[model samples]
Target: MIGTLDKAKLKERYDICIVGSGPSGMTLAAELAYSGLKIAMIESGSFKRSSLAEELKEVQSEKLPIKANSRERVVGGASSTWGGLSALLDPADLAHWPLSFDELLPYLKAAAKYHFPSLETFQNPSGTGWKFKNLADKLFVAVRPPFNFTSLVNIFNRKGVDLYTEATVAKLVSQNGRIKKVLCRSVDGQGFEVSAEIFILACGGIENSRLLLVSGLGNEYDQVGRYFMNHPKGYAGRLHLSKPLPVNNYYLPRVVGGRMVYAGLRLEEELQKEKGLLNACVQFEPDLGIFQKYAFAIWRRMPGFSTKVLTIFLPRTLRARWFADMEPRAENRVILSDKLDRFGSPLPKVVYDLSERDKATLEELFSQLRSGVERLELGKLTGTAADVLKVVKDDASHHLGGTRMGLSPQESVVNTECRVHSSENLYVVGGSVFPSAGCASPTMTMVALSIRLAEHVKSKLASKPRRTFKNQTSRTSSQKILIIGAGNRVRGDVLPVLESLPGFEITGIFARHASSLFGAHRSYDVRTMESLSVENLKGARFLYVSVPRETLAQVLSDLPGASSLEVIIDTPVLPAVKKYAHKFKRIHVAEDSVFLPWLDGLKGREVKEIECSQSVFRYHGMALVKAFGPINYGYRLGNKLYLKAGNTKVKIIEPRDYASGKLKIDGQEPDLTAIIAELIPEERGLLGEIKSTDTIVSKMGELKRVGLRRLLLAASRGEETWSLEEGLNDVRIDWLLHKVWIYLSI
Candidate 1:
């Protein structure tokens, strides 16, 4: 199933088509192998590197030089030269991520299981006598043999996955909001096409953006190759210790659990936050060769003192090297070059510029490190700022961003699920979707996110029956509904759907002030009410509550026909209201968070497992039983919901912000939302009822001109646009809020 051959040798079609055989693509292929979906992975190079394949990597750069050799076109991709340094992004560094640390932790652990199996203990050094704010701590780096596709070729051969090497993806052809086919070329000038239900661009950062730009796929927001970032490394300074300290293997490479691992040092998250500094780490290498080169210069400056100092502390001295985060800048980008490769594909041009803030961060980091080392008496630093600058290098080969993920198409190239904003079935994987690059190597994180993406793709492929949308005819015996909210969701979102439904009659709308109901139609019966009364609930059969969380309890308590009327409450419900929800004839709370539709789609299907967001944890204990019926379930230690009902076993996780919003059944995610909207009586014809763009414009327009201008500027600069009505409306902010609530709740 794994071979390097012509493009004509590939299968006619597959369930999933992945471009690139890098770590991200390989990890995803492995995860989806046994999920009953056929996978096709395309790599431009064969098992080994070649001159022709390497020529494709040649790129033009502006300020920072592009390391053409950093990326290998062979089956292993960059792993050919990767240092194998593996570490989770610091919690502080993850502030820019859509998911939380806890949500991504499981995937990181999964990736670590494969790469850094024998993890050495990471502990802070004690009794260093360094009384400084920032100190060096332990960090784990994987020194195992680099992982290449050939290593996993046998496993892939057995699974439902096929790897095709020497296949260069030329262009992605999309039709009707979905990727229809991928046109590819072999090295020998053979051309072919591969079709798939879902297409994933797992290519490296530069290529991913380049392909999208070339094909005009996901550039609707003009953000395809924007917000480029990378880690810049340099020689920080030198340290000469008074005496040899008890340094552990964490600071040096050593065998642990039968694997070679080394540790480095990073500034604590708290200190970085306090100083408003970028994340950075330093490693010390005892280099006598470097000392010998610098000895002559030191001897010329001070002959006798230099000789005595060098003799006493020659072995104890260490050369310090630092790696720091680069801020994402729109100007620092990847664009299509005028030059073309052998295949007639345009080459990439990378424009990178180091900001003044970056230099200041490096200066502060070294100054603090030196102060700490000298104060602790652990070491005496002996290097000028000029010496540090002189040894600085431009490239780390870690390209990030250009396909940044966010909740909206206007601000990012991809959605939180890694799906390209413009194309429904097109997804981008790798460091390209990273909003910001932390100080750590991106390979581990790339693998982790890819694993998560595999589960999502599997689930999507499994739930196929419910993916289609069908128009429904109106019924004669319709129910009377009343919306009780003072937000634009009533007029812009709920009202249109209600009016379009055949049997649903809008009785009345209630709000505190007439202006609060600004978007409502004049034909509708809109009324101002100070408080809920029996008259308001007169003839309504169903009540839709979309009020603020604080007012939910009051609205629930004031309900007049609680015994007969069915109530649909928006999610993140108040605990007190949930406790008394059973009082109604029938109650259904809307878990509007992304994964809920997947659960709704599985209503009549035979499901093996169901995983959902834990945003509804308050109602899960009772709501799940009420929804699924007679299920035996228990709570796992990691806040996972484990349930077994009949032949089905379910596990649910409340994801951290940056995690994927997907529901899985039997390790597969089906288009349950579409199914639920089609099959379910209550949800029929109401899927995608909210128009996010319209609601966002309306809510944003409510702000003063000056405030709106400020937000527009921030959004343009790739910063968070914290709106007050974020969750109250149907804007992308709801998706963002759902992801970041764990941080905001604190």
Candidate 2:
């Protein structure tokens, strides 16, 4: 349902919360809706453009020129001002990516299909029609109307999806390494909160980095706002043909299969790689105006010459425009300014610098292009290198590379899954996550990555055990289970699955209200805390506690003979609960992050060494233990933890060091799958060595004090650890301790 931000009417919780209703955010919302997960999308603007909202987009640029209409803050984002040009990133451009072209091809194809449903083919011819060795001929450029959310109005209205317009997320609230809530405010300055299981920042390139910086989120590697890039474009020259040549509609936008398509010139990928030159493309348009009219008048005076001129030479008076790639440089960056917006958020200060390589690349490319045209006798290029430089503009409105993707947190803001390095559930999607921007319009690539991200989210949701209704006419003597806390997780994640099983039935539920239990079976009795007694717990074979951590101990203590029953806690047990460990015969704490399926292979394989390079704050320790086995001995070397059992060795490197390219195992680069494998088995044994009141306080304090980025920097420099009182408060430390216990127990 599309509505204004009304905290009173909004649901208290959602499965996913997406910030910014741009192409990437909307595409992800549509893709994830198929899975039936409740989604909430928050946009800063409404359907129509607003001066107030647009004012927030104001940015100060240094060196590079900022386009006045570069970004839109409305419902559709930049799509509102986009000139739909679809093209894929060159394979050579993705050399640094962990994902290969083959891996990304399906998503790219899907994105193409989404944009052009009737697209028959995308293949371009090998060489330009002009016979020149270096001249690039047929370049694939698909033209379609800019993507607008209005086109997906019906999709946005889908059930379980809530889109809040004019609601801007100002900051993210983190607790125990998870984003628990988002503080949002309207343009009118009304404030509210939206909580969700997973949070995604799809608020364009500039805003993406800006929000993270203000919230002190994913900047662990100091790479969040760096490597800013844009496709530098300018007038190359004019083409004067030696002979009248027939120019086809391929050079111009023409309707084909009910969609607009155009073909331009791209330096072949092989040629660019061979020459060690950057990717660049050029397009030609007939130089129309007074010159064309006068030429036509002169040509009409000679019938024979006029026929040739009308057929070919008229189309030869073409203007050339060049688009070239910009190398990713650290100096080109976006940072927060001292000035604040109306909402009190810092305005982004973009510092863009065109490198010497960029200038040389353009000069070399146009020179080659001029030679190619002249050599083929196709045309004579007019305009010197100086003219090209003078007319060039850095405002393609293609803002890219702020929250780039890399293998580790130190190298980039997000991981391969697009999840933030320090936070497990936080993700960022859009051009901001691009590690490098090739000389192609970013819309196509952004859409493809959004599709991939949607799939990943869906898979993660599917991996969690949720409720599924089943019909059963007969009931037999089965195990009776008592459940506490009638919240979303119990009702949505536990009840349905439990009811579907033939051998189990929910005997009782302890919650504030019975009506809150969704699809509640009549046979099950619901009771409040005061009314509950030992008689209700008698004969119940299994007791499941899904209550808040604070009340868990009280709830467990209230039940008599609790030691006789099997207890399963939804959350990780606290260290304080160890004193009551003897009360329950078998205590099981659910650890959702652990995937048992990943351990399908390697039963007796002789594994050498395992290296886990993950964010220390968001590490999956228990899952590691279950995957590997028992650890015999372990020690810490600086920020890395090393554990060994017989022949296999496990190393847990700090996330920043991993991203800085410091962690290596057996001379091999860090692999997440392999590292987690080694790190998991040794988790249980190593847990005791690393577990301490001071250590836990120190880590959490570091996370809060400097944020993940600065915390990593301090750890790398071997800075002094914070004291318990100076560290995270007792409540947060208690939460951290419980998480550690969960990992150790698992």
Question: For every model in order, what is the number of clashing pairs?
Answer: 17, 8
* Window of ten residues with lowest summed lDDT in model 2: 682-691
Candidate 2 displacement at residue 690 in angstroms: 57
Runs off by more than 4 Å, candidate 2: 117-120, 124-128, 137-140, 244-249, 290-314, 463-746
Q: Please list all clashing residue pairs in model 2, or write none if there are none.
A: 128-137, 220-709, 563-583, 611-675, 624-680, 624-681, 625-680, 628-681
Which candidate's TM-score is highest? 2
The candidate 1 region of ten consecutive residues with least summed lDDT is: 696-705
Which portions of model 1 show Cα errors greater than 4 Å? Answer: 4-8, 117-131, 136-138, 290-314, 464-746
In lDDT terms, how accurate is model 2?
A: 0.64
Please report how far candidate 1 places residue 664 from its true position, in Å.
Answer: 58
- Residue-level lDDT of model 1, residues 623-706, one tens digit each, is 342245444434443455455555566555654221234444566645433443344343332332222232211222111222
TM-score of each model, in listed order: 0.58, 0.59
Candidate 1 similarity to native, TM-score:
0.58
